[model samples]
Target: MRVPLRDTVAVAAGVLAPFVAALALLPLRTSVTHTNLALLLVVVVVAVSALGNRLAGALAALSAAAWFDFFATAPYQSFHIQDRADVETAVLLLVVGLIVSQLAAYGRTMKRVAVADATHLERLHGTTRLARAGGSSADVVRRVRQELVEVLELRSCRFEYGTLIGRPPRLDPDGSVQVEGWVWDLERQGWPEGEIELRALVHGRYQGRFLMTPAPGSVPPPLEARLVAADLAAQAAAALDEDAVSAARRS
Candidate 1:
């Protein structure tokens, strides 16, 4: 796969920015304290972390430490640092840079999670609104089937009415999967081979089930997402039950 232009730029900057900054500081080596120089390099690491990714940030940190030892410390033009204080400063620079990178990576992860949660809520809200609007049963089922494919990241999904034919992996309301007779650890392991079942029930009545086929080598969705899918299935069942009641009254 081709890398994004922005990422390529970031990685290049991460590796080179520290070297450039250290060279610029060469004249000030005699005037500036070693601790102050290390702090300045930390700033470069922070900038790289903000612009790029964790790997970029880490590379920046390593580059900064190496250049600092070579150009700014005693035994100049070499990696070896004779001064103990300079040695401490070099080690600290690398440590601080790594920590900043990890924190940046964590912040990015939280942001993605927040966006995903909002999307899940919208899917649930839309389905509930449609059901309340007196939409047709087929419409409700169709909408739910589409939503399931998205929420669960399934390759394909279809609804089956009435009797369930055979034993398949069942997605429970609590987000646990019952396979054969045991619960599968979905987090560590991805979806099992073959089709999975998501049953839809209304007031203890077996309304229907959704047969979902997982994509080959697809990552397993989180528990929260699985719960949202189950909720959507429930909405479809409720819509079907409402239609059944209306037909019975007419008869």
Candidate 2:
């Protein structure tokens, strides 16, 4: 995989930070045992993991252990470590630092998941209320359209009952998920022709389509967005169906 420049920089910084610190603290080599230096490097591993991803943290840990062996072990200033205890200490540092990095990365993942789940719940709850509101058909459609744009965080979104318009949907007929091709227009800063449509099928009756233009690179995570869209589509189906009933009764 191609690594981004920012991530490469983070990994380099993670390694270099502890390596440089080991060099500067070399003056205390006589007083600080290899064990003490290993402990100090554990702190460096944690810090690097906090700032960067797990891979960067692992690299930082290995760099710290290697540098500790060269600068702080019995055969000082060389990769060679003559003492068995020092060898064990170095191994512990590497293992412990890896564990710490994994935990840190896991924590970051959980935090992001929590935030996303909360947003999804809030969006669905608000849409339910909006769909259930009593109003003219046009006002109901307009409100739901506004909710669609806000909930999906899109540049623009619209809804209309009946079949999807213009072209075939991005997804296969049986699929509910889509993230696909777009050709941008400079003035609009978005796709001029391409759009994605999520259909609302209730009781085997296709109610309508939610047509939207995504902001550049703003697609949601694949699984979560699809599940939420499926749920949202149900609410959309109900609202559109009601709007149709109202329009018929008023005529």
Candidate 3:
């Protein structure tokens, strides 16, 4: 498996950075207070945490604590500390570094979620605009098919007009999956085998459905994405209903 370059850099830095930093401070050990030295090591931990993930941050914290004990404490170059204050400083350094790493990880997670939400909104807006453009019903169906494939991470998607066939896993508007009259644990089990159906309805009457074949071994899409796909299907059904009404009036 190919590892990401960022991760490789992070891991290397996490292990080596504390040693380099502590050695650099060795010359000033007699002049600098141990508390001040510990704070500097904490800064090194923070930098590694921001540059990489939680694992990288944790490695940095551990490295920073171990190096601080060996290089900064009494009996120079020895892990044993004669002073109680120095030992406390080393303990606090490790604890603070760990807390900072967890916070950094949380911040990264929130950033990713915000980006995903924005993309979902754009998909919905684009589909709504196409449906309102007064284009042919075929055009709307085609556009929706493309969106469904992307939003659901499906291998393929197609529109089926009128009449329900054999029962398959059904994607409800609420983003739950129903199979054989039972609710499938979609989030835990991923998509079931075979095709799934997302029905398009107007005022309780069926307009059509999109038969979706999920990509094998693909992670089940999040609820927010599934909801957006359902909304897109509703837009397609509304457009088709309007086109049918226009044809009847013309005749």
Q: Please report, in order, the local distance difference test score of every candidate based on alpha carbons.
A: 0.89, 0.71, 0.88
- Highest lDDT: which candidate? 1
Clash pairs detected, candidate 2: none
Judge candidate 3 against the unseen true structure and give its global Cα lDDT, from 0 to 1: 0.88
Candidate 3 lowest-lDDT run of ten: 1-10
Global Cα lDDT for candidate 1:
0.89
TM-score of the candidate numbered 1?
A: 0.75
Model 2: per-residue Cα lDDT over 197-241, one tens digit each: 767766767887778776665534345655675677767677767
Write candidate 3's Cα lDDT for 129-243 as tens digits.
8777767789888999998999888999999998999999999999999999999998778898999999998777689999999987877888889999999898888888888
* TM per prediction: 0.75, 0.74, 0.73
Q: RMSD of model 3, in Å?
A: 4.4
Off by over 4 Å in 2: 1-12, 133-156, 160-162, 166-194, 215-222, 249-251
Q: Estimate the TM-score for candidate 3.
A: 0.73
Q: What is the full ranking by lDDT, best candidate first?
A: 1, 3, 2
